[model samples]
Target: MAPKGSTFKSCSCRDETGKKLGRKCQRLNRPDGRWSSTHGRWNYQLELPPHADGTRRSPLRRAGYANQTDAEAELNQAKELLNIAANDQALARQIADLITTAVKTTKQLPSPEEVRRKVRTGQHLNITTTLGEYLPQWLQGRKTLRESSRRSYASNLKLYLIPSLGHIRIDRLRVADVDRMFEEIDELNDLITRARETCDPVLRAQVKGRRRVGAATKQRIRATLRSALKKAIREGLTEVNVASLVELPSGKAPKALVWTPERIAQWRTDLDTHIATMSARRKRLWKDTPSQGHGHNLNRIDAYVGAPRPSKVMVWTPALTKQFLERAELHRWYALYYLIAFRGLRRGEACGLRWTDVDLDVGTVTIRWQIIQIGPEIFEGQPKSDAGEATISLDTSTVTVLRTHRAKQNAERLAAGDTWHDTGLVFTDELGRSIRPNEVTDQFERLAMETGLPPIRLHDLRHGAASFLLAAGHDMKTVQETLRLSSIAIAADTYTSLLPQLARQSAEDAAAIILNAEPAR
Candidate 1:
């Protein structure tokens, strides 16, 4: 006999009308009126507790067990799960609803331990949430992320993560699925590359303004996914972070290369060739469409051939640096350029520096703030890292230049009188307003080009500072401290190639030590 209290029994025999006889089937009972064992499959039902709102709930029902033992085991498991919510009606209702949904959909019972964990943590009891559904909610709840970081996470989710893997159940996400997303990104990259290379305007237009998803960006996307899944794990939504298991190509930064005489020569030749090739292509395009005048074609070619840099990163030699600075000395923001070139201040840092942070007598400047540009807006923010906020020692020449720049700024302030906006920044416009970081960069580029030196970016001034420190025989740790880098490894990795002069001098010194050594036993 099956146990009593919301019973367990078996009945598969159907009446002639074709409806299941259910518990009323005749074979369910023996001739003596005891229950029969082999007539039909076993099933069970139990009265569920009332809902949290005190409304009635249908009794929990499950069927299709092989025998009474199987039916009793499942019934015991259900009772155990329902017992987890003892004394908490809301939790009881949640567990009952979860069981009902699981049976109706997947037919798989959630583990009792897992359910208990979700309850204890107050996580969502629903186990069927998809990543697409959860990621946006997770991102919305992240109240402390920096604006740039939040934007990155949002972009990754909208463009890559959600579009590719959103439909998969969060619990069922696997490393292979993540890997396939990156594979699709790679395929798209191939398409973009081909589209950009094609001469046809339609082909080019199809991929216009779409940059390749580089390895570093791929790494960032993975980081965003991993972070989301990590929170999910903490919330008991997932058992594993499949994103952490996938491998990716190294996203190491490109080492800074010093622009030597030979490299500059080669770069000039390459730039000339690139311009000529673009000119020829433009002419062909113009020939194909005679309605587009030659002037329009020439202007387009000029815009397209805007002096592409030879490398992603390049630094200047001491002589070149001197030439550029000498030319920049005539510019109004010469002190800004000088501070960055010598003291390793970033563009934003220089623009953001205030007179109060500078100690002319002590020759130290604290880097507590930086002007960060997000899209078109500018805002003051903390330095990139804790190390970036520390005070850096300024050279005597730099102190003198800053003093002069202060005097010039004071004069400008006097000239503006009531109109002057006293932002207190060291670098500002004639009206005493804070200088935009991009304006500083544009001025740097213009001065650099005017100096007739090989091209380098405004930020490359930081790289040049590292090279200068290395060439002057400073140790890597010293360079790290001077540059205020977060780690010595960053300094070493970026400046390992060093200036050619330093390498040559080291080579000569090593050879001399061996050549001058006397023969020994």
Candidate 2:
């Protein structure tokens, strides 16, 4: 184990002259000698050279024991480490050096657990690796992530994580550091809010330089750090995930607010006042002094004054939805509006719909694919989840809209002749190419503005559909199925705002049931 003839021997010195004989001195060299009381300490010479190729050449030796027993025991421990290391010559060298350093310099042994971990993950027990250095490698190895997901991860890392926590060592990262980053982010949000509130061009230009990072954005940034740290743990870079320990302001799911009669009235009144006042102010300002900066200044002023802060998830009442559908009939993509408003198809799902996925004969459409957007580029990808790919039964009214839309589309195709592209989609541009999702949203906004109705995003149409179903007394589970949400909990949480109305309806139904009972039979 300790090489041939490698055993405990006491340092002997009978001669005090010249080289002084060292361990080869004659007095203490005898095997049977209980003599030489002058030799007080025992020493062992164990040779352990660098076993790995390209490793720096170094002598591995440990000594200075009070007795031969102590010397042999230390030798046995080194032998055991060599046995464990086996074929890993690098590990064997590290273990040898670690043991040697313990005996010679510090007289303290390193933990066996720490030693093995360094060897396994190739971290070499170094505690100075920064998050910035590690996260890039971690993301690079995440080859299985989709394009959109990868872009999101990269964006969070570049825009938030690296800028904030890049220089902090992986092992030295603390929960306090993570918390401070979020606190700063919250402060940045306040700055953005102030910038938007101020109409001063210089103040707005200075403060509105960066996009507002909201609570949702902060949560995503935390998720990115948490995910990266998890990889570090698996690779044995750090024992604890500090990111997991930090807490941030939890982003609440924005409740979808429906436009009631009072809200519609307020919206109309505000719109008329804003337009009339803005027109008069613009005319007076231009007549007084037409400066070069007048146009730019007026645009900025209008953005703050006239722009309405829409709810995160806004919905329209049943009457408003009906009116929207009736007006949308004049639109070329009336079938698209009808399908989303009734069936609750997502914007991407509606855009990705092909004729093959839709069955006009059976009155059903299978949501199999969705057009996902990363920046400006769009690609047809599978649904967000397995539940997202569902076959929804279309109502008779929707089927009729589809038929009429198909007839009109056929007429357009005939007129275009060879110029039309054969995309075979249920909804597309006039040239038959796929419609951009953002274009659809912009069109929806313009149309809603034209109708003088409350503003709602195109995605909110799906929320309206869910609200309609719940209002009709359908179970939450049924709504979950119709929307193709991954779980009933999501459906319950999202539509929980509607529960108060449902409760009143339930109460009325209970009273009617009792009143209509037949003689307590």
Candidate 3:
């Protein structure tokens, strides 16, 4: 019956003659069912025992095969796994495609979720679109900022920071971007000091120098940028403060050359002669030249002469308070200097001084308001701070200085007749207008010139005033209070220098106190 209807290829052959073979070659089963032959050796996939939950498991969890049954089972499981993987992948693609379609159809910018979805689906997004959208939302609803501070930040943003960092999406700001920005800042020479020309090209070519900002300006920018970035982080716009991380370029310290008392005394003698000679000539020439030109000429001459600041006005001394009482100058400002030195008035406080603020009868000067000029803008304003409003103690000597100055002013007032400009100010211009501190600095610079001393600024007078008290054995706390300094460190750092002669004098005072106080031992 033809082997029960089976289909098989048979080769007809004879043993040794051309005759039909009664017996054909034995049938061989072709390799099948996940089994393959390698040089007559069998190879196949493996299958593991099922999990306890009746789920099929893989024997060749990673690779290779075990036996026939195991191989068959593994082949079956792998086929199923590959099918499941394909289906899941297709579903994920479908979902992503649907999200993209919905976003595009709705005419909406993709949310962060959509961005992640697009990324997962291998899509690209514009960085600026992603990052810039978050900025305005980030700045909303923030309070606790001062008006002037806000204005400064606004100006900085409009003028500098935004112009540099705008259009660069936050995400686009990588380490490379940071490096490039720093490079740009370097390339433009946007720093505090110019670079030194060196032979080494690598260092010279490198963006090695830090970004340099002036201390006062740097302090302001740092404060503002900190607040801005803190707001950025709070609103989840940025992960870090890049500005905070970058090192600001360092600055050279101020070189101070305060004159010694001996140097000051010598310079003062020379200055007196020059000042007397100049004052006489200046009075005559003052009306003929331009006011600014005259001031400029004097300043330039003073600078060339290397004139020191006024002895009492520019350089302070331990006995400055008492010395000012003795060698009172024009307007007797030395007396005013002593008032602030002893009593802690702002130069404006001293300038704003009134015969009324100075109660010679009671030896107290009441500080209520101050007359000050920022530029040419002049007005009476509240004392710069709360500490500004306080009573200053005047010594009997200060009272006497003031009484004499007041008498002099009074005589001048009478001489001027109807033009006394009775503002009751202790210090005044020739027109009796309140004396500007700039004018004071100008006078100080001229005085310093006249004295044949190194030129010093008027604010140095404030420094000198504080230094004298510290040298005279006052505590930092007392000096701080006396200067109305916001902090003790400010009082100490600007003042406190030890003099060997002062140390010897202190030793002598101690020795004298001990030797003179005790009986013969």
Top TM-score prediction, candidate number: 1
Candidate 2 differs from the real structure by a C-alpha RMSD in angstroms, to one decimal, of 11.1
Ordered list by TM-score, greatest first: 1, 2, 3
lDDT tens readout by residue for model 1, 188-300: 89876544332445555766645578888999999999999999989888878999999999887776777766778887787677667666766776678766555213332
Each prediction's whole-model lDDT (CA): 0.81, 0.73, 0.51
Cα distance off (Å), candidate 1, residue 310:
7.0
> How well does model 2 score by local distance difference test?
0.73
- C-alpha RMSD values across all candidates: 8.5, 11.1, 19.5
Q: Candidate 1 at 449: error in angstroms?
A: 3.9
Off by over 4 Å in 1: 1-54, 58-96, 99-213, 284-311, 411-419, 499-501, 505-521
Q: How well is each residue in 173-242 modelled by candidate 2, as lDDT tens digits? A: 8898888888877777777655444334454676643667767877788888899988888777777788
Question: What TM-score, over all chains together, does every model reach?
Answer: 0.68, 0.66, 0.47
Residue-pair clashes per prediction, in order, are: 0, 0, 8
Error of 1 at 328 (Å): 3.0
Clashing residue pairs in candidate 1 (N, C-alpha, C atoms within 3 angstroms): none
Question: Per-residue lDDT tens digits of candidate 3, residues 369-426?
Answer: 6766543545565666566577767778768877877777777787888876878788
Clashing pairs in 3: 45-71, 48-59, 271-450, 271-451, 307-453, 307-454, 308-453, 308-454
